[model samples]
Target: MQKQADRVVQILKSKGLRVTPQRFAVYANLLERLDHPTADQILNDLNQDAPTSSQATVYLSLQTLRDAGLVREVLLEQGVCRYDANVEPHHHFRCRCCGKIEDIEWDAFEGLSFRKLRAGLKVDSYEITVNGVCDRCQH
Candidate 1:
């Protein structure tokens, strides 16, 4: 967590972006939370810690972090958007029952043939989202 806090500043400076409290707080929160959280959810959590941080601040901070390539935005069902701090190449498994998003390893796709993707012109980046009920929800 401490390392991520410092990383937030380093990444911001490397991207030539000014470091602000709200932006730092937002990124720090994202780093701590492994669960992909929506902007509203993030704002709610931040309100508990820093009362001064507003929705706009959180939204703007999210945009800035995304623009700096420090985070990845996950677009889920029903126009729901979740933020992930792990920017590495990976996929997602979403729980249909509880709306939880879990990261799936990139190596998991190694054996599968991406015929459609391979035939495509060029794929810069891609993320596969699988929707199903989680174990906890299955019961």
Candidate 2:
């Protein structure tokens, strides 16, 4: 766990961001859990070990991490915002029945392109979220 924390710190430093203990804790927690937690959920978990961690700190840290390209914000139905630590080029599979979000392998969309869909619009990044009942929920 310490090694992972150290690597996170190094990554933050490389991104020219300050390496605060609060930030480290936040990042580590995100790394530990890939369930895509909301800011409130993250704050609640952080307060378990760090009572001094305020909501503002977590929010700021998330924003900073997002700015540094270390995390991504996922918006689900009803405008729920969740934080995802995986910054790779992939999509997500959302289980509507249980609100579970899982990573979709990049190879699923390999060699797929949509640049020709529009003429004058420059496409940046795109996210494809498949929503349905997961296998566990189906069973």
Candidate 3:
């Protein structure tokens, strides 16, 4: 836990952000859960042990963390955003039946890049979401 805390502090300092208690709580939650939770989901889970923590606090913390590049948000669908603690490049596989998000690590694809036919086009990152029943859901 101390190592994770140190990492959080380092990230905040490197990004010129303050490492506040609320921010740490939010970040620690994301790191521990690894579930790619929505804002509401994060609030609910945090409330279990932190009843005084407000929904707005969670939102603000999430936004700050995202802005600092310590966390990443993936828009899986319309009006739905999921928070990911893993900032490293990777793909996500969503289970259509259960709405479960799974990370697919393919380092080979991380360096993949392509040129656009049109001018002034650039691709910062790549994404490939396989929408289908995952193995567990199929069984």
lDDT-wise, the better of 2 and 3 is 2
Clash count per candidate: 0, 0, 0
1-139 in candidate 2: lDDT tens per residue? 8887777777888988888988887888899897999999999998886488889999999998888777889886677889988989778899989888899977787687876786888778788888999999998
As for lDDT, the candidate ahead, 1 or 3, is 1
- In candidate 1, what are the lDDT values of residues 1-139, reduced to their tens digit? 6787787789889999999988887888898898999999899998985487888899999999999888888887778888999999988898989977899998777666556665557766677888999999999
What lDDT is reached at residue 50 by model 1?
47
Q: Candidate 3, residues 1-139: lDDT per residue as tens digits? A: 8998898889889988888888988888898876699989888887896586788999999999998888999987789999999989888888899888888885635545575447776766667776789888898
Give the CA lDDT, 0 to 100, for residue 78 in model 3: 80
* Pairs of residues at least 3 apart in sequence or in different chains that clash in candidate 1: none
Least accurate stretch of 10 residues (summed lDDT) in model 3? 108-117
Runs of candidate 2 exceeding 4 Å displacement: 110-116
Candidates sorted on TM-score, descending:
1, 2, 3
lDDT against true structure, model 3: 0.85
Per-model TM-score, in order, reads 0.88, 0.86, 0.86
